[model samples]
Target: MTQSMEDFITDAFEQNYERIRLETGRAVTPNIKEAAREQVLLYYRRMRDVADGVTDTEVKLTLPEQRTPQQRKFTLEGVVDIVREGDRTTMYDVKTHLDADAAAGQLDQYVQQLNLYAHIWQGLRGEALDETAIIATRPTRELRQALRSGDDRVIDAAILKWRPCLNIPLDEHAVEDTVQRFGTVVDRIEERHFMPPAVEKLKAPIRPGARQPFGTAVCANCDVRFTCDSYRQFRLQTTPGMNPERVLQDAMNEYAASSEQGQWVDANMETLNRDRLPDAEDIDRGDV
Candidate 1:
């Protein structure tokens, strides 16, 4: 007896979902769970026939402490997957996105991170790395639309056309520079220097790599936005001009004259008017 692909996918999804729940104590809604299952199924379907040359997965690397005279000790660590084919080796860092090219502006940051990993691999571990790339698992909009439509033909067509891999260039020379910047950040943390950026800066993009204002893209998603003075100031600066007193008065008037209250009063008045009217039976018997 052979196991079908659908059955295999279902078993894999259940196992992974359970593991995630147990490890992280994270609960997802039904829609999110279904989407995750679809992603897994799509990945498997695409990679089923391709030779990945996967030698190792989830390979954790801890770089040695490069900064000296520090109050506290810290090490940079990262996880990556390695693919080896004969003498050539490739390192892959997996990322999830709706579009693979959505992070194009952040390429430099990725390069710096991957360069550090390359340094650790080549310089520290004496392992040769031929290439480094980001395997973005982006389930395309077409596939998602097809899934929503529940059309098998459309889904199959979309799945076959979907491509999610993005290759990143390896910059070995930037490794030392990236490491120095990391040391500076660690020093700031150890010194308890947690000063936030200015309000004007918060209104600007987080970095040259970002596409939108930091307030819109990053600060809006932050849980502590309401408590942050900079965020409050940014919101005030961006909000449309309005008379606070007039707005307050208008709100009060609206609450007082709400449609539901008006409806209730009208209904009561109608009942009272009906009660005061002459009875049809009395009029008919001439007994009014």
Candidate 2:
């Protein structure tokens, strides 16, 4: 499906926001992705006895109609590995190929997917779910640790805060008002010729010993490797000018200097350090 502009912006904002929270030790959203992963793991935990068991199962959850004029109705597609022993109602998502460490690292993405599904599940079950998890065979030890460290309360709280953004108020004139505001912004940008600031010109160049990796976790499975300029340059050169190490150092220095002088940095340094820098490895895996 074609991506929406709002979705892209929202993803970017959430990623940066979460990263800042992690780096600065600020309380942000709990790891929803890990929660979903645990839900999948739980499904597999039930089927340890059945060898050569179920490959894939899809669960469709239907929700009740809402009183809102623009309520969103969607479906939750759950891939299950096993059904619980006695109830057969609960299921799990087992990770067979994806490693636990890797999954844990990408838990945010998983949580986003799970929360998306949970929204649909709530609609279907006509009640809020207490918890949802995933199951995986690989990284057994890592997965076990993750399960123990899982926190549903945090995930639920994050979801509550996130719900408003997900389900934007779509009352009368909402669409028109948004369109009008967008037009105004476009006009303003056009009036200024849409030129990027000088500092924004710092491009992402590739360097040596860089490994550009992409997967389902980040970039939503988009083939951004080819499209990312840093990736291509990293493949060709041993020293890409815009290596993340240099970039991060520059950002940190700039932030420190700004703070020392009581100057506003304008950019969210915490967000950049936590989120964007880490992802830079995936986009341009070159050593600084």
Candidate 3:
């Protein structure tokens, strides 16, 4: 039997609520929860009707060290939201509940995930995917029927309105490079250089209004800030509402070769030496 939209929405929303809470270390209120529910419902509506492709569905890839023979180090996995079956298979990561302003920023780690998916597909099954896409939606009351008129026609139609930015493309060469970089990261980890790297790893920068308005620095949404040595050092070295220029500049440079929408810049911005960890550690909290 097919489940009603309400049932699926409840299940998806609850799952999202729990996953976000665990990842970000905060509580979500009823209003936020309801907004999330609406997003899930909206996603289903599009998959049911609007997409031009045939039979789009979510996917997951398991990559062992063997897949990256050059690296020969670690295994990893990624879950992709849309893999459309057709003359040429394409991958897309679906984003929901974001406004026009925030939709692009919300695509954190999508490039990495999608790249790995493409790389592994070529090795295990066949050639790389023909294309990659990110589908982000801003919901409105009349979105489902808006597709009928098309051509950004929904822009002027409704109250608390919604619009979608679809078919945002990913580059083939960039995806290949990203997959190669993933292997390099795993290769480094496997090296086991007798300690952590010289650089300090940082957390992601979150959505300004939606997830972490208070965050101005890279550690803004870090759940273990009080207990982590790296986070503590980040605080002492920087002030709130201020992002270090060096970090920002480096991120910009890295994304220079990529598209405006897909080149996401978040944390992992700055690096602190391993020698400095002792100074940043809190002995009371055992954050050494």
Candidate 4:
């Protein structure tokens, strides 16, 4: 008998999640585990229809002999999945974007990356490409809410409305330009040219085409944001006319550090009579 997708997902989740739990030596919280299960179910439901003929996944492709003025020839590497039918081929690049709309906002970036992949496939592997697409694995907010609600009807409705696959039109003509840009970035990295975007740029959308701000969508997820001057400025600008010290204290309190770590942050903040913060006094006065 064929196993149902729901049962399959449950089994797969138990096996894989257990492996991860053992490897990491960490326990998965109930909320996080459920969210992960929902994410996997969403991907499987959307992909099962179209994931046939997958020839390879985690495919590493090399683009060779890229040149920059500051550096000699070098190679760029990327991993993607390839699907084949007869002589035609398609490439799939999966990302963890918030949803299709979020993915669409940054479609041009994906197009450039895919174009580089296609160039390598055609030039190096001598393959015929039929299509290129991005599969964003994040479940929609409505679906997540419905799942949390544990209502079957709402889940079915959300599943019907969700669209995860975004077909991107590849421009092979743009490959050279993209490669040059990649080489330029590599040269900058090698030269230790670590300049970041201006504060104003971080406050604005990542690009003119995108609606999400660079600070929220990009900087928030970055590892080195706390050390970035522009991000610091961006945070200050987000709450205009606020006391810098108060803003900093609030930010520190919001960090989700491990419980095992000392409560030095809270303890230190207590030393500051937070009652003296301007906003707190204003709010208190308004209440009176």
* Number of the predicted model whose lDDT against the real structure is largest: 4
Once fitted onto the true fold, the runs of candidate 1 whose alpha carbons sit more than 4 angstroms away are 1-6, 23-26, 45-52, 68-72, 97-99, 138-163, 195-288
Q: What is the lDDT of candidate 3?
A: 0.51
Q: Regarding lDDT, does 2 or 4 come out ahead? A: 4
Q: List model 1 lDDT by residue over 139-225, tens digit each.
A: 755666887888889888877887666567788789878877788788887787666568888777655755567665556556656
**Consecutive 10-residue window with the lowest summed lDDT within model 1:** 247-256
Each candidate's root-mean-square deviation in Å?
A: 15.8, 21.2, 14.9, 12.6
Model 4 residue 87 lDDT? 79
Each candidate's lDDT (Cα)? Answer: 0.69, 0.40, 0.51, 0.76
Order the candidate numbers by TM-score, best to worst: 4, 1, 3, 2
Compute the lDDT for candidate 4: 0.76
Q: How would you encode candidate 3's per-residue C-alpha lDDT over 1-288 as one tens digit per residue?
A: 125756866886788766765565445444445656765655555444435353445566777654343646556776655445656666666655444434445454556566667666666757557776665665633554564466454633531254454444454465556656777766665775323211133333345454422222333434444444454444445444555665444433432334422222211111123223555346767877
- Residue-level lDDT for 86 in candidate 4: 76
**Backbone clashes (count) for model 3:** 0
Candidate 2: count the clashes.
Answer: 29
In candidate 1, which residue pairs clash?
A: none
Candidate 2: stretches off by over 4 Å: 1-56, 61-78, 85-90, 94-97, 126-130, 136-224, 234-288
Model 2, 71: alpha-carbon shift in Å?
12
